[model samples]
Structures are given as C-alpha cells and as structure tokens.
Target: MYRYDEFDETIVRERVKQFRGQVARRLSGELTEEQFKPLRLMNGLYLQLHAYMLRVAIPYGVLSSRQLRRLAHVARRYDKGYGHFTTRQNIQYNWPALVDVPDILDALADVEMHAIQTSGNCIRNVTSDQYAGAAADEVEDPRPWCEIIRQWSTFHPEFSYLPRKFKIAVTASPHDRAAVKVHDIGLILKKGEGGKTGFEVIVGGGLGRTPYIGHTIRDFLPKEHILSYLEAIMRVYNLNGRRDNLFKSRIKILVNTEGPENFRDQVEAEWEKIRDCDIDIPREEIERIKRYFAPPAFEALPGESASFEAARARDAGFDRWVRVNVVAHKVPGYAIANVSLKEPGRPPGDATAEQMEAVADLGERFSFDEIRVTHEQNLCLPHVRKDDLYAVYQALKEAGLAAANVGLASDIIACPGLDYCDLANARSIPIAQALAERFAASGEEEDLGELKINISGCINACGHHHIGHIGILGVDKKGEEFYQITLGGSGAEDASLGEIAGRGLSSSEVVDAVERLARFYKRERREGERFLDAYRRLGHDAFKGAIYADA
Candidate 1:
C-alpha cells in the first residue's frame, strides 16, 4: 500500500482545516444550500434523501488493516453502525451529521484516508483490479499506475471542472476484472515491443442514461507517456464535450456524436503538442511508486496445501466456499480470498462495523495486513495462504461474511437506491435482497454458475446494472415501483451493454422474473455454456419470451 509522505500529509491536513471552516459556514447559515453544494461535493459530502452521505475513497481498492479499522471506527462512532462499499471501490457513510462531517474527515485523515475526489464533477477515484499484485494472470500490478494517475489528477487545475465526472480504471490482467472497457479512460497493461511494458488505451467508455463500451484509441501507448496521453484525452474532452445539456455532457456522448476516429484524431493532435513536455511522471518517481506495491515476502511452499485439501475433503461447506470465494494466487501456496458482502437478506455491499473489524483482523493475520475492495462490491484478502483458507473461512463465517456466493446468482450488485439517493426513482436494495433470498431458498445458486445480477435504483447506473449478466433497473410507473430487465450484459473482457428484455415487472414479479430467466437458462443452455454465453447464443428474445410469457 502507498504510504503518505510529508507532502501528502500537509495537503490532507490543510484540506481538513479548510473544509472545517467551510462546513461551519454552511451550518451557521453564512452559506446557503446552493452556495455550499459544490463545496460540499468537492469534499465528498452529499445531501441524500433522508440525510447527508459521506463517500470516502479507497484508492485503487487497496487498504491497510489500520485503515480498515479506522473505517470501522467511523461507522461505529459517526454513522449507523455500518458502511456501504460501492462499485467505484469506495465506501459511503449514509447517516453522518452535518456538523460532525468535519470531525469524520479528521478521523479519516488520521489513517491516511480522506473523502477528497470521491465525489464532484472532477476526476473521481481511480480504481483497479482487486487481485492486482496477487493474480496469476496479471502482466504486473496495476496499482502503481493507478497511484500515478491519482497523483496526477488530484487537484488538477485543468480538469477541476469537467462537463461531467470523469472516471479511470486500469487492469494488468487479460481477464479484465477491473471492467476497464466501461470507464471514461481504461488502460490495459501489456507487453509491447521488445517485451517492454505499455498500455492499450480505451476512451469515452461510460454508463449512465447512455451506455458505451469505450473505443480503443491507442493500440499501444508507452507506459512512460501515459500521463501525457491522458492529458491529451482530457484536453480534447474538456474542449469539445457538450456543455449545453446535462444529459449529453459526458465524454461518451461526445465520442458518440463526433465518432471514435475523430475523437482519437483530436487526442492525437493534442498529444503531439504536449507528449514531450514536463507533464509525464519522471522515471525515478514511477520506480518509487512501484516499490510501494512490491509483493509481500512468501515462504517457498508446495503449490498445493495438504491441510487445505484435507479441510476441503472434511467439510462440504468449506469445499463449497473454496470453490466459489477463493482464486489462484501468482505465488505458490497462496490464494486470493474474496469476501462476499452479498449475504442473503442483507443489503448487497453493506458491511457492519463488526464485520469490517473482523475482515481487518483477518487481513492483518493472513494477508500481509492488507485488504482490497473489488469493483463488484466485495472485499478481498488478496494474499492469504492456501493452508490458512479454512481458518479465514471460519472467521468470515463467524462474522456472517462468508456466503460462498461469488459469481453466483445470489452475489448481487445493487445501489442504495431510494433507500438513500434522492436522485433515485425507485428502491433497489429490496429488489436485491428479495432476489438473493429467493436464490438462497431455492439452493440453486451454485448450480447456476457465474451469474451476475446487478440492480440500479435509477439510470445513473451507479450499480453498474448495464454490465450484469442479468440487469434490473428500477423505474417509476404511475406511483408503483417497476423493474426493467436487461439481458446479455457483461463487464468482462467481452464488455457490452445489455439489451432491454421487455416490459417492466412490478416488485413482486421482478424476483420471479429473474427466477424464470435462471430456470430458462438452465433448461435451454447448451453443454458447457455459462449464463452469459448462453444469452449471447440465444439472444434477448429467448430470455424475454421466458420472462414475459405470462406477463
């Protein structure tokens, strides 16, 4: 994990001091709601439907155990005993008092964490692969580069106020766990000419009212030139992206209106002007950042752990959990354990203060005192020993964090819809809860295999419903809550927006509708086909026919 330096410490302390005064002004009526909107947003505070929500950034999803413990403290002391981990690899405190926000920020600053850039029209938190350093398939850890971008973008005067919020993501794995294709800027690290590291850059990818899988603007951009290239892209978007309509302001809309080729050309022309300037990070600084993410020391152990195998043989529950929640590590005898936050009957990403503390302790004991937040709304112990898998599972089980439903039908991604957000048209958490319960009750989650069901309160797509294998978007229908389903969506390497299946289903019908889709897939899928593959082969009509056959 990246540690804060003297400069980092100074800036955070100064920001906290400055925001303390700003917040005091707002509470004292010296600043009206309109006057304080941008100021509060810049500090990651939002006036939600019922209360103020504070979003704190967990950069590139990495956290030290100490940091996690601090977050747990904040939840226990300030909010309502829980925090919501978000799809952007951030966490939200939903019930912080207006006057107490500065105190909360000060608490966060103590642990080298803050809410800066977590919200606002400026560049948001830079996210990356949860399994970055530990993944067996990775070209290299992407977190260093993510850190580089974070350093470059934070408080950047040029991109301080874009037409819309900008998001960037990076991945070093070919498996695409970061969902790079759906970001405003996506970078895939790859071995370029002479086996040197470089990036394949994608631009204008986003999901909101309009969704798009980004265009590959640069087939290969040297790692050394990443900052300059990103600057070029930002310059292009800032100059030409629409400012007239709120709905049409995103870079994706600009890319669509001007076409990818023209957008790429514009970026290239801009890059030609500044690529050689002093904007790119120095080689020494890059190497310095890289040192922070160096892999933790590992004992030379056999690839397979006999104790782990014995535990799996002894316990069916342990075996099932290992099958679903554990992934292979790049290091022998180690594993990346995903902690599923989507327990049946719970809000998808809500982690109780105790659960957070439990996970922090588990990470401290097993994973080099580090925890990772996945873009899919899960926490990860990115470097646990395979031999310790059972112990970790037992601890998680005790904390109610071990659901063993990763990539299963029960592992849902849902936003805090009308439950929190004033922008939401309908509630999303209940739908997610109902679906998870339905799947768990049926005991078909394991059988379904690698199903992603994402629910969004509204079309802002905060839940990333556009990329789920089965997407449920809440819509208001004559004072009734309805869900519009979409099929064949994926956020993987084969990223694509889902097609709307058919008419909206009422709250009661939506869960059954999802069940129908799953059962239909089970019946209709060809041998060896997953839900997504089957959907692609069968198309939207088949799923639509099954769901709406009785509508």
Candidate 2:
C-alpha cells in the first residue's frame, strides 16, 4: 500500500479542518441545506434517506491489516455495527451523525485513509483489479498507476467540479476484472514492441441511464505519457461535456453526441499542446510508487500442501470454501482467497465490525497482512499461503465471513438502493436478498453455473447491473417498485452491454421472473455452456419469451 507522506498528511488534515468549520457554520444556521450540500458532498458525506452516509475511500482497494482494523473500529464506534463495501471497492457507513463526520475522517486519517474524492464530480477513487500484484496472469501490478492517478486527480483544480463524476480503472491483465469498460477512463497495461510498458487507453465508458462500453482512444499510450493523456481527456470533457442537463452531463454523453472519432481527434489536438508539460510522468516517481507494491517475502514450498488436503477432505464446508473462494496466485505456493460478504440473506457486500476485525486478524496471521476489495464487492486476502488455506477458511467461517459463493448466482452485486441512497427510486437490497434466497431454495444456483446477477437501484448503475450475466434495474412506476431485467452483458475482453428483455416486473414478481429466466437458460444451454455463452448463442428472445410468456 502507498504510505502517506508529510505533504499528503498535511493536505488531508487541512481538508478535515476546513470541513469541520463548514459543518459548524451549517449547524450555526449561517448556511442553509442548499448552501451546505456541495461542501458535504466534496467531503464524501451524503444525507441519505434516513441518515448521513460516509463513504470512506480504500484507495485502489488495498488495505493494511491495521487499516482494516481501524475501519472496524469506526463502524462500531459511529453509526451501525457494519459497513457496506461498494462496487468501486470503497466502503460506506449508512448511518452516522452529522456532527461525528469530522471525527470519523480523523479516525480514517489516523490510518492514512480518507473519504476524499470518494464522491463528487471530480475523479473518484482510482480502482484496479483487486488481485493486481497477486494474479498469475498479470503483466504488472496496476495499483501504482492507480495511486499515481489518485494523487493527480485528487483536488485537481481543473476537474474539481466536472459536469459529472469521473471514474478510472486500470488492469494489468488481459482479463477485465475491474470492469474497465464501464469506467469514464479505463487503462489496460500491456507491453510495447521493445518490451516497454504502456497503457491501452479507453474513454467515454459508463453505465447510468445511457450505458456505453468505452471506445479505444489510444491503442498504445507510452508509460511516460499517462497523466498527460488523461489531462487531455479531462480537458476535452470539461470544456464541452453537457452542463445544462444532469442526465446528459457525463463524458459518455459528450462522446455519444460528438462521435468517438471526433472526440478522439479533439483529445489528440489537446494532447499535442500539453503532452510534455508538467503532467508528464517521471520514471523515478513511477519506480518509487512501484516499490511500495513489491511482492512480500515468500518461502519456496511444495506445490500442494498435505495438511491442507487433509483438512479439506475432513470438512465439507471448508472444501467448498477453498474450491470457490481461493484463486490462482502469481506465486505457486500462494493463493488469493476471497472473503465473501454475500452470505444468504445479509446485505450484499456488507461486513460487520467484528467480521472486518476478524478478516484483519486473519490477514495478518495467515496472509501477508494485506487485503483487497474486489470490484464484485468482496474482500480479499491476496497473498495467502496455499499451505494455510484450511486454517484461514476455518477462521473466516467462524467469523461468519466464509461463503463459498464467489462468481456464483447467489453472490449478487447490489447497491445501497432505496434503503439508503437518496437517488434511488426503489429498493435494491431487498430484491437482491429475495432473489438470492429464492435461488438457494430452488437448488438452481449450482445448475446456473458461474452466473452473475447484478442489481442497481437506479440507472446510475452503481451496482454495475449493465454488465452482469443477468442484470436487474429497479425503477419506480406510479410510486410502486418495479424491476426490469437484461441478459447477456459482460465486462471482459469481449465486453458488451446487456439488452433489456421486455416489460418490467413488479417487486413481487421479480424473483419468480428471474427464476423462470434461469430455468430457461439451464434448459436451453448446450453442454458445458455458461449463462452468458448460452445467452449469446440463443439471444435474448429465448429468455425474454420464458420471462414474459404468462404476463
């Protein structure tokens, strides 16, 4: 993880002090609610449906054991006993007193964390593949670049108040685990012709009311020019992106209106002037940032651990957890273990204070004292030893953090919908819960096979429903909650936005509709076909007919 330097510390401390004064002025009745809105939002505070929600940034989704422990402390001390991990790999506390926000920020600052840029129209937290350094297929760790972008984008005068929020995601591997295609700006790190590293830059991708896969603006951006190129894109959007209409304010709208070719041309014209300016990335700085993410010390061990095998054979639950939760690591003896937050009926991506502390302890004891928050809204111990897998699994299970449902149908990705979010028109968590329980009860999860069901309370697509194998979007119709389903979207190398099936379903009918769609896929799929593959083969009509047949 990137440690905060004196400059970083000073900036955050000053920002907290400023926000404290702002809060005081508001409380003193000097500032009205309208006057205080932007100030609170800039500090990552939101006045939600019931209470103030504080979104704390876990930069690039990396956390030290100590940092995780502090988060647990904050959750227990202020607001509720749990915090929800979001799709962007940040965590949100849904209930917090307005007066206690500064204290919360201070507590976060104590661990070198903050809520800065977690919200607002400026660049939000720069996310990346959760398994960045640990993934076996990675060409390079993407966190350092994410960190660089984070610093550059934080409080950037030019982009501080954009037309809308901006997002950036980077991935070193060919696989798009970070959902780069759905970001405002997506960078894929790859090797150049002479074995030099560079980025494949894509811009204008977003999901909201108008979902779009990013277009490739630069096929190969040199490593030294990343910041400069990003500046060009931001400048283009800042100057011409829609400002009159909130719904069309995103860069995606601008890109759509102007066409990608013209947008790319404008960016290139801007880049020609500022390409070698102050934003040019220095090699030494890159190396310095990279040093923080170097692999931890490891001892060479046998490919398979005998004791681990013994525990797996003896414990059926442990075996299931190991099979689903653990992933391949770059190092042979190490594995990336996903600590699932999606357990049966609980809110998806939520971890209790105790569970968070337990995970922190487990990371320190069995892994490398480091943790990651995946884009799928799960926590990860990215450098666990394969030899200690069973021990870790047992510890996680005891903490109510062991769910063997990674990438499974029941492991749904959901946003804090009407339950918390003010922008939401209908509830997403309840629908997610109902569907998860339905699938678990029907024994359809195992048969569904690697299905992703993502739900967003609204069109903002915070839950990334646009890219799920089965996407559900909640809308309000005449003050009633309704859900519309989409099928066949993916966020990988062959990324595609899902197509809506047909008429929306009422909240009562949603779970049944999803069940019917799943059964249709299962029955129609050829041997060894995943839901997505089958959807691609048969198209949305097959599933649409099954869902709307009796309507």
Candidate 3:
C-alpha cells in the first residue's frame, strides 16, 4: 500500500481544516442547503433520504490492516455500526451527523485515507483489479500506475470541474477483474514490441441512463506517457463535452455524438502538444511508487498444502468455500481469498464494524497485513498462504463473514435504492434480500454456476445492473415499484451492455421471473455451461419467453 508522504499528509490535513469550517457555517445557518451542497459534496458528504452519507475512498481498493481498522473505528464511532462497500471499491456511511463529518475526515486522514474525489464531477477514485499484484496472469501490477494517476489528478486545477464526473480504471490481467471497459477511461497494461510495457487505452465507456462498452482509442501508448495521454483526453472532453444538459454532459455522450474516430483524432491532436510538456512522471518517481507495491517476503514451501487438502477432504462446507472463494496467486503456495459480503438475506456490500475489524485481523495474521476491496463489493486477502486456509476459513466463519457464494446468484450487487437514496424509485435492499434468500433456500445458487444479479433503484446504474447476467432495474409504474430485467450483460474482457427482456415486472413478480429464467437455463444449458455462457448461446428470446411464460 502507498503510504502518505509529507505532501500527502499536509494537503489532507489542510483540507480537513477547511471543510471543518465549511461544515460549521452550514450548521450555524450561515450557509443554506443550496450553498452548502457543493462544499459538502466536495468533501464526500451527501444528504440522502434519511441522513448524511459519507463516502470514504480506498485508493485503488488497497488497504493496510491499519487502514481497515481505522475504518472500523469510524463506523463504530460516528454513524451506524456498519458501512456499505460500493462498486467503486469505496465505503459509504449511510447515517452520519452533518457536524461529525470533519471528525470522520480527520480520522480517515490519520490513516492516509480521505473522501476526496470520491464524489463530484472530477476523476473519482481510480479503481483497478483487486488482485492486481497477486493475480497469476498479470503482466504487471497496475496499482503503481493507479497511484500515479491519483497523485496527478487530485485537486488538478485544469480537470477539477469537468462537465460531469469522470472514472478511470486499469487492469493488467486478461480476465478483466477491474471492469475497465465500463469506465470513462480504461487502461489495459500489455507488452508491446521489444517487450516494453505500455497501455491499450480505451475511451468513452460508462453506464447510467445511457451505457457504452468504450472504444479502443489507442492500440499501444507508452507507459511513460500515460499522464500526457490522459491529459489530452481530459482536455478534449473539457473543451467540447456538453455543459448545457446534465444528461448529455459525460464524455461518453461527447464521444458517441462526435463518433469514436473523430474523438480519437481530437485526442491524438491534443496529445501531440501535451506529450512534449513536463506532464509525464519521471522514471525515478515511477520506480519509487512501484516499491510500495512490491511482493511480500515469502517462505519457501511446496505448491500444494497438505493441511489445506486434508481439511478440504474432511469438510464439505470448507471445500465448497475453497472452490469459489479461493483463486490462484502469482506466487507459489499463496492464494487470493475473497471474503464475501453477500450473505443470505443481507444487503449486498455491507459489513458491520465487527466484521471489518475481523477481516482486518485476519489479513494481518494470515495475509501480509494487506486487504483489497473488490469491484464486486467484497474484501480480498491478496496473499494468504495455502497452508493457513482452514484457519482463515474458521475465523471468517466465526465472524459470520464466510459465505461461499462468490460469483454466485446470491453474490449480488445492489445500490441503496429508495431505502436510503432520495433519487431512488424503489427499495433495492429488500429486493436483493428476497432474491438472495430464495437462491439460498433452494440451494440452487451453486448449481446455477457463476451468475451475476445486479439491482439498481433507478437508471443511474449505481449497482452496475447494466452489466449483470440478470440485471434488475427498479422502475416507478403509477407510483408503484416495478423491476425491469436485462439479460446477458457482462463487465469483463468481452464486455457488452445487457438488453431489456420486455416489460417491467412488479416487485412481487420479479423474483419469480428470475427463478423462471434460472429454471430455463438449468433445463437447457449444455454441460458445464455457466449462466452467462448459456444466456449468450440461447439468446434473449429463450430467457425472455421463460420469464414471461407465466405472466
């Protein structure tokens, strides 16, 4: 993890002091709601349906055990006893008093963390593959680049207030765990000719009322010139992106309107100018940042853990967990273990303070005192010894954090819809809960095989419903909640936006509709076919007919 230097520390503390005064004035009635809106948003505070929500950034989703512990402390002290981990790999406190925000910010700063750029129309927290350094198939760790971008973008005067919010993601692995294709700017690290590292830059990808899978603007951009290229893209968007209509403000809209070829031409033209300036990070600084993410010291051990194998042979539940939650690590005898936040009947992506602390402790004891927040709203111990798997599993079980449902139907991604958000049309949590319970009780989630079910309260796509295998969008029909379903969407290397299956179903009918679709897939799928693969093969008509067969 990147530790804060004096410069980083100074700016964070200074920002906290400035925001403290801003908050006090608002509390004293010196600032009206309208006046305080931007100020509060600048500091990552949102006035939600019931209370103020504070979103704290976990940069590139990397956290030290110490930082995780600090977050647990904040959750316990300021707001409710839990916090919701978001798709952006940040955490949200749904119930915080307005006055205590500064204190929360201070606590976060104490651990080299902050809420800066977590919101607003600026480049939000740069997300990446949660298993960046640890993944077996990675060409290079993308976090150092993520950190470089963070240092470059934070409080950048030229790009601070874009036409709309911007998002950027990086991935080095071919599997696309970072969902880079759905970001405003996506970078895929790869080796070019002469084995030199560079990025394949993709632009204009986003999801909201309108969604796009992004277009590859540059086949290969030298890694050294990443910032220059990014600046060029930002400059193009800032100059021509729509300012008159909020709906048309995003860079995706501009890219689509102008066409990818013209947009790429403009960016290339801008890059020719900016690339010669002093925008790129020097090699020395790049090496310095890379040191912060070097692999941990490892003990020499055989690839297979005898204890892990024996335990798996003995315990069915533990074996099931190992099948889904554990993944291949780059180093021998190490594994990347996912801690699922999606327990049955629970709101997806939420963790109690206790659970957070427990995972922190587990990471310290078993992994290398490091944890990662996934784009899927889960925590990961990026470097756990295979020999210690059972002990870690037992501890997670005791903490109620052991749900062997990674990538399953129950492992849903849902936003805080009408239950918390003022912009929401219907409740998202209950719908997620109902569906998760349905899957769990039937013991069909494992059988369904690697399905994604995402729900959003509105068209904003906060839950990333546009990319789920079964995407559910909540709609208001005559002031009543109706859930719309989209099928075959994926946010992977083969990224594609889902298609709506037809009319929206009432909240009461949505779960059964999903069940019907699942049944149809199970009955019709080829051997070993996942839900996504089957859906793609069977086409929309198959599932659409199944869901509406009983309608």
Candidate 4:
C-alpha cells in the first residue's frame, strides 16, 4: 500500500478545510441546494432518497489492515454500523448526516484514504485486478501504473470539468479480471521484444445507457510514455466529446461517432507532439512506485500441505469452503482466500462494522497484513498460508463471513435499488435475495458452476448488469416495477454484453424466472461447461423459452 507523504497529507487537509466551509454555508442557508450540489458532489457526497450517502475510495481495491480498521471505525462512529462496498471498488455509507460528512472525510484522510475523485466527471478511482502482485498469470504488476495514472489524473485542470465522468482500469493478467474492456480507458500490461514492459492502450469502452467494449487504440505504448499518451486521449475527448446532451456526453459516444481508426489517428497525432515532453513519466519514478508493491517475505514450503488436507478431510464445511473460496497462489505454500459477503438473505455487499473489524484482524494475523476488495463484492486475503486454512475458515465462520459461494449462482452481484437509490425503479436487493434463497434451498447453486447473476435497479448499469452471465435489469412499465432477464453476458477476457431474453417479469415472478433459466441451462449444458459457455452454445432462445413459457 502507498502511504501518504507530507505533500499528500497537506493537500488532503487543505481540501477538507475547504469542503468544511462549503458544507457550513449550505447548512446555514447561505447557499441553496442547487448552489451546493456540485460542491458536495465533488467531494463524494450524494443526497440519496433518505439521507446523504458518502462514498470513500479504496484505490485499486488494495487496503492495509490499518486502513481497513480505520474504515471500520468510521462505519461504527459516524453513521450506521455498516458500509456497502460498491462495484467500482469503493465503499458507500448510506446514512451519514450532512453535517458530519466533513468529519468523516477528515477521519478518512487520517488513514491516507479520501472521498476525492470517487465521484465526479473527472477520472474516478484507478482500479486493477485484486490479485495484482500475487496472480500467477501476471506479466507485470499493474498497480504502479494505476497509481501513476491516479497521481496524474487527480485535480488535473484540463480534465476537471469533462462532459462526463471517465474511468480507467489496468490488468496485467490474460484473464482480464478487472473488466478492462468495459472501462473508458483500459490498459493491459505486456512485455515486448526485450521483455520491456508496455501497455495495450484501450479506449472508449463503457456501460451505462449505451454499452461498449473499449477499442484498442494503441497496440503497444512504451511504459515511459503512459502519462503523455493518456493526456492525449483526454485532450481529444475534452475537445470533441458532446456537451449538448448529458446522455451522449461520454468519450465512448465520441469514439463511436468517429470510428476507432479515426479516433486512433487523432490520438496518435496528439501523442506525437507530446510523447517526449516533460510530462513523460521518468524511469526512476516508476521504479520508486514499484518498490512499494514488491512481494512480501514469503517462506518456502511444500506445495502439498499434510495438515491442510487432514483438516479438510475431517470437516465437511471447511472442505466445501476450500473448494469454492480458495484459489492457487503464485507462491507455492500460499493461497488466495475469498471472504464471501453474499451470505443468504443479506444484501450482497453489505459488511457490518464488526465484520469489517474482524476481516482486518484476519488479514493482519493470517494474510501478511494485506487485504483486497474483489470486483465481485467480496474481500480477499491474497496470501494466506495453505497450512492455516482451517483456522482462517473458523475465524471467518464465527464472524458471519464464511460462505463458500464464490462464482456459484448464490454469489450474486446486485445494486442498491429503490431501497436506497432515488434513480431506481424496481427493487434489486429483494430480487437478488429471493434468487439466492431459492438456489440455496434447492442446493442447486453448487451444480450450476461459475454463474454470474447481476442486478441493476435502472439502466444506469451501476451493478454492471450488462456483463453478468445472467443480467437482470429493473424496468418501470405503466408505473409498475418489472425485471428483464438477459443471457450470454460476460465480463472476462472474451467480454460480451448480454442479450435480452423476452418480456420483463413482474416482481413476484423474478425468482421463478431465474430458476427456470438455471434449470434450462443445467439440462442443456455439456460436461464441465459453465453457464456462459453453455448459453453461448445453446443460444438465448433455449433459456428464453423456459422463462417466457407462459408468454
């Protein structure tokens, strides 16, 4: 984790002081709601239906045990005793008092975390794969580049007021766990002829009202020129991106209007002028950042652990958990363990203050003081020793964080729909809860391997509904809330948007509809085929007929 320096501390303190004054003015009636809207939004405060919600950025989803404890403290003291982790790799506090938000931001700054750039038209959080430095398949760690981009995009005057918000994600693995294809800018770390690192710079991918898989603009850009190349892309979008309609203001729209070739040509022309300018990142700075992410002291041990296997053999619960929640680590004796937040009947990403504190404790004791938040709304202990698997499972089970559903149907991804969001039409949490319970009771989730079911209350796609294996979108028709189902969507290396199945189902019909699709896939699937693979092979009609049988 990158600790804040003197400069970082000073700037965050100054930003908090300025916002404190702005908030005081709003509360004292010196400024109206409309007047204070932009100012509050700039600081990651939103006026939702019931109360103000504060979103705090967790950069690239990496957290030290110390930072995680501070977040737990914030959750306990300031607002409700819980926080909701969002899809963008940030956490949201739903009921913070408007007057208490400044103090919350101050509390966050004390831990070198903040709400800055978590919300706004400028570049949002620079996300990467959770298993960045630890993944076996990584060509290079992508966090240094993400951090570099973070430092560059923070308060850059040129992009401070873009037509729409922009997002950038970096992934070093061939697996594309970061969903780079669906970001405004996506960078894949790759090695060239001399094993020198560079980026496959992708541009224009996004999901909202209109969805797109970002196009690769530069096949290979030198590592040193990342900042300059990004500046060129931002400059091009800022100059020509639409300002008239808020709906079409994103860079994706601009890239679509002008074909990828023309977009690439324009960016290349801009890059030629600035590629070797003073803005280019120096090699020393890159090296300096890289040092912060170097591997921790990993002891050499055998790949097969006798104690670990013996413990799993004794306990059925632990054995099932190990099968679903544990993954192979780059290091021989260590394993990557996922702490599932999707316990049946709870909101998918909600972690109580006590649970957060427990997780921090687990990370410190068993995982080399490091924790990561997964894009699937789970917490990961990235470097847990294989020998301590049973003890870690026991700790998690006691804390109510030990569900064994990682990629199963029960491990659902859902947004705060009508329950918390004013923009929502139907309720997503209930639909997700209903489906998870339905699957759990039938014991069918384990059989339906690697199914991703994502739900969004509205078309804004905050839940990433566009990329789920089974995507559920909440729609309002004749003032009634209905759920639409889509199949064949995936957010992997072969990224593809889901297609709508048929007519939207009523709220009461949602769970039954999802179960029908599951049954259809199970009947049609070949050996070891995932729901996505089978959906692609069988096509949408096979599942669509199951759900729309009455229609």
lDDT of 4 by residue, 1-551 (tens): 67777988997889899999999999999999999999988888999999999999999999989899999998999878999998878999999998998999899889898898888788999999989888889998888888889889888999989999999999999999899999999999998878887999989998888999989998888888999999999999999999999999999999999999999999999999988789977889888888888888999999989999999999999999999999889999889999999998999999999999999999999998999998889999999999988889999999999999998998999999999999998899999888888888888778788999999999998888899999999999999999999888888889999998888989888788888888888888899999899988887788889887654
What's every prediction's RMSD, in angstroms?
Answer: 0.9, 1.3, 0.8, 1.0
Give the per-residue lDDT of model 2 (tens digit) for 1-551: 78888999998998888999999999999999999999999988988888888999998899999999999999999968999999998999989999899899999889898999888899999999999889999988888899999889989999999999999999999888998988899999999899988999999898988999999988898887899999999999999999999999999999989999999999999999999788976889889888998888987877788888898899988887888778988887888999999988999999999999999999899778898998899999998888888888888889988878899888999998998888998899999999888887776576677899999999888888889988999998999888999888888777999999888899988888888888888888899999999889987788789887666
Clash pairs of candidate 2? Answer: none
Error of 2 at 342 (Å): 0.5
Worst 10 residues of 1 by lDDT: 542-551
lDDT of 2 at 477: 92
| Candidate 2 regions with alpha-carbon error over 4 angstroms | 549-551
The lDDT values for all models are 0.93, 0.89, 0.93, 0.91
Off-target runs (Cα >4 Å) in candidate 1 are: none
Q: What are the per-residue Cα lDDT tens digits for candidate 1 across 82-163?
A: 9999999999999999899999999999998999988888899999999999999999889999999998998999998999
Q: Which parts of model 3 are misplaced by more than 4 Å?
A: none
Task: Looking at model 3, report the run of 10 residues with the lowest lDDT sum.
Answer: 293-302
Clashes of each: 0, 0, 0, 1
TM-score of each: 0.99, 0.98, 0.99, 0.99
Model 3: per-residue Cα lDDT over 5-82, one tens digit each: 899999999999999999989889999999999988877889898899999999899999899999999999997889
